[model samples]
Target: MENKKERYQVALVSEDQKINEDINFFLEDRFHIDVFSNGVVLYNHLTKEPDKYDFILSVSGLTGVHGLPLKETIHKLGFSHIPFFLVVDKADNDMIQICIQNGITDIFIKPLDKITLQTRLDFQLKHPVVGWKKRKQEDKGFNSYKMPFVKRVFDLLVAGTVLLILSPLFLIVALLIKLESKGPVVYYSYRVGTGYNIFKFYKFRSMFTGADAKLHQLKHLNQYSTEKQEPSDLEPERQEVKELCEFCEQAGGGCLRPLYDDNQIVCEKIFNARKKSDKESAFIKIKDDPRVTKVGKFIRNTSIDELPQLWNVIKGDMSLVGNRPLPLYEAEKITTDKYSLRFLGPAGITGLWQVEKRGRGEMSEEERLSLDNDYVKNFSVWFDLKILLRTIPALFQSENV
Candidate 1:
């Protein structure tokens, strides 16, 4: 008697009913497909029965919860060992780069080519990702027998001494904060740190009470917001581009091919025209923000706002030198696994980026993240000391804090 081959279990997440049907029809014969509509449902199911599925296939921009964020959640849940494949409508250079960073096994762009997908699936199955070797290697030094101990001891000694000496200054700052603001003197911010750990990050309140409520009013002041033209302003140009796209599609060319190909003169012209209209920057900075109070300006400029974080360091919520802990909103933006490596090291009030750039308005978001990754990859006791020394000078620099 011959033994029957065991079928591979695959989980498919897509909000589109038609896409789900198509994927199921194509894959059901060879694999057991568990279909889900949104990332939340899929995530809950996976958490309960992670071992049931061999891999996951998800749509990139699902409505309820997006794929990249879903992947981040999975990693946080300690289920990163499972492989993921994302399906996208049009894979641009940025999207492809993001996918690569997120540890996606493969990307299947729409008008899904069934044959190519099958081949890719077969290849992935044959070569399953046993572990994230690169991330492991980057983290190895920090995780070694002696480094963590040495790092913690240094944090204790330094943070302890600073708190003791700064106690009087802390009292003065607390009183000033109370006189200026109606809210608590110390702002306890919710921040995401190493390994997706959540902690209350301490800082002096550098903005007026209810400042967060005024964010919408200040959107125009956000330096990172991409400049936009009113729809009416761009309608004619958009129609022209639409016609060009249709022409290319009719001429046996892909709708997205022109956008991806720099050699396409027509495409390049239209793209450049559109590019000139949209001014985008990744880093957000507002010149002389009105949200800050008079005392707030002084504290932020002199880096006094960061003093209360010494308590967090002593409490073991952070280290003296590591990646800066991110607010939940900011952390959510960094969903890619490659960018997530920034979380492998400890969260700190000051790190390589702070020492190197001192909140220079010129630093791009990617550059900042890269510095965090660099610190993780090359962290040592001596390196930390050097960064600490450099931080002293940076504290006096008159730049955006």
Candidate 2:
């Protein structure tokens, strides 16, 4: 018999009683479990007894606190040493990438296999997640992309010269941005680049202040937003189209996929399948976006807003010619096996996609990913030079992408 003191202590947080009960049933034999109904309560308890658990397992969506935000809070509160695992109903590629980017120690999909859960927990017990470490794609069998020495030297030389000569233009742009908007001159956001590496990406402030906070509200304006199909009045058709996942809805199991919930309790997998069938593009792009200021519009049209990225190139976050680095949300959506090859090459300011399809006004997400993958598979210094030369003429083409 195992001694009570020898068992690992676990904290499980979930609002679903059935889920809590099911997880407890699977884990009770091997670990000591303390359950919390929400993240706030667990956080409060941890404050008083920080060392009470060796690991934390929480549902993605909570009543008082969401999983990703709670993890951010935990890190901010200096609890970065504790292993934190996220529990989701379905483990979609996008969700997995998002969780890993946010430093989740591990993720467990719903209808959790007992043996797999036990094995994972046992391993985590022996080697607890210590400091919050960024997870990379090395273990997934992709070699980390390294910039060639010639490319690196070229980037440094070009970026250095551009910053030197364009220093005056940058100041002028900064003044115009500050005069036009009430925010800082430069905007910076986290971007995922080669090998799934996250870095701070910079650009001159083109959109209005607080543009990011309003992104969700303005998703309807996205050029890539799919038109939803109105349900047919035919009963048989509606019945046939009713989305129900095998393990989630059809099996009468509790809701496992929460990301796609349409306020109707539909599983994420089912909802995503519906969206996929509808041909929704995961990439969001808006033409003539309402968020851009007049100054923003002018700078963006001339590609002057992109100049600050020279600093990023100088810092080795990117190269002069490669696939453009993507925003976090965009990166998450494309992390599936079909599109992940894009990340195995250098991320950059301009590349094959930009030169080939920037002003075409009809580049689909699949085409863009395909172009990026092609670049990754056959990039060389000579090819980079050709791309750089092509970019010079297209630099001032105004598409308002």
Candidate 3:
């Protein structure tokens, strides 16, 4: 007798009863489906147990929410590896491109092909997407760079000495943090490090208790986003002119924008309109972030906020000098082949990127990732010492202010 296949948990969101029924008819046998009427309800359910669902299925345009922003939020919360499939009413090139850019796994147009959909879903289940946990276990021998004995010795010595000497300072900072904020003195979060290893990264708390919850709301203030698109003289004129589609000519105006989908023209004004989220920068770095307390600002500027990471270094989660470990959200964005090289090196408290452009706030995402790769290529005891020396000067300077 053939063994029964495991039923994967799926979260399907749609208000259209017929669509949900149609999808259930095809997938229920192989998957356990939990239906949600809207994205907001699904999102709340997801936050409680982000790893519960094997995958997610949602309509292209949710009842009250747009699909792309929801995907972005899910990725930002460190659940990017979950396969999120979008079902659109019709095939739309612009919607497809946007979905691809945001890392949606697949798209299915209306009147889904049962054979094609089932085959793709089965294939995905058999070969599931790798998350950080699996990557850490499987890639260790092949991808992780073994720390040299001398390097490990140096990290321990330096980290130990600094932490011991700064004990009094740590106490003072902790007191200040407590006095200024209602949160814990130290902020710890899951950060992706060398070889895609996830670890609890610690820092002196520099913001309020719920600062992280406010991150998405404050995305508009990101300094990096401001630089994503340079101002052009013709931008004003471009926004005013609603380009007409020759394929859908009318008296007043044709389609605002025409997008080709499988050789068919789709006049989608709804999808084409400029959205505030589209302006959000891939990298999040806000100048004078409002969430920061007065004590937070002082610690951040003086580099005191990062001092707590010495504990991480001593605990073997990082090194004194290597590529800085990235938060889960930032790390997820750079997992493409071109940028994955950064993970082969050690996670660090201070590194080449910090030394090169610590407070300039001008380094683009590409430049930062390239510098990380560069450090991975040239890292040595001597190279690390040079970077350590450079870090002292960089810490004292803050052109970003």
Q: Give me the runs in candidate 3 sitting further than 4 Å from their true place.
A: 1-29, 32-107, 110-142, 226-280, 359-361
> Across residues 1-401, which tens digit of lDDT does each residue of candidate 2 receive?
96565777888876678877888888887678888764545555665676678888887632114476667655543465677888765556756776778777888877778887888888877776653333211122446577789999999999999999999999999999988889889879877788656788999999988888766655556666666334343322211224557776555756555452212234456666675555446678877788999999999888899999999999999998888888755664453566778988999999999899877686777788999999998899999999999888787676788
RMSD to native for every prediction? 8.8, 10.5, 9.0
Q: Which stretches of candidate 2 lie over 4 Å from their true place?
A: 1-140, 228-275
lDDT per residue (tens digit) for residues 1-401 in model 1: 97786688888877678878888777776788888754545545664575788778887542113466667666655556667888765556755775677777777887777787778877777776666544434332212112388889989999999999999999999899899878889888677777556678899998998987765455566555565322232212212224355455667643443333211223533554665244243345665789999889999899999999999999998989899987655665565556767877878878999887765665656678899999988988899999998988888887754
lDDT of 2: 0.74
- Give candidate 1's TM-score: 0.61
Name the regions of candidate 1 deviating beyond 4 angstroms: 1-65, 72-147, 223-283, 359-361
Positional deviation of 62 in candidate 2, in angstroms?
A: 17
lDDT-superior candidate, 2 or 3: 2
lDDT of each: 0.70, 0.74, 0.73
Among these predictions, the greatest lDDT belongs to 2
Best-fitting candidate, measured by TM-score?
Answer: 2
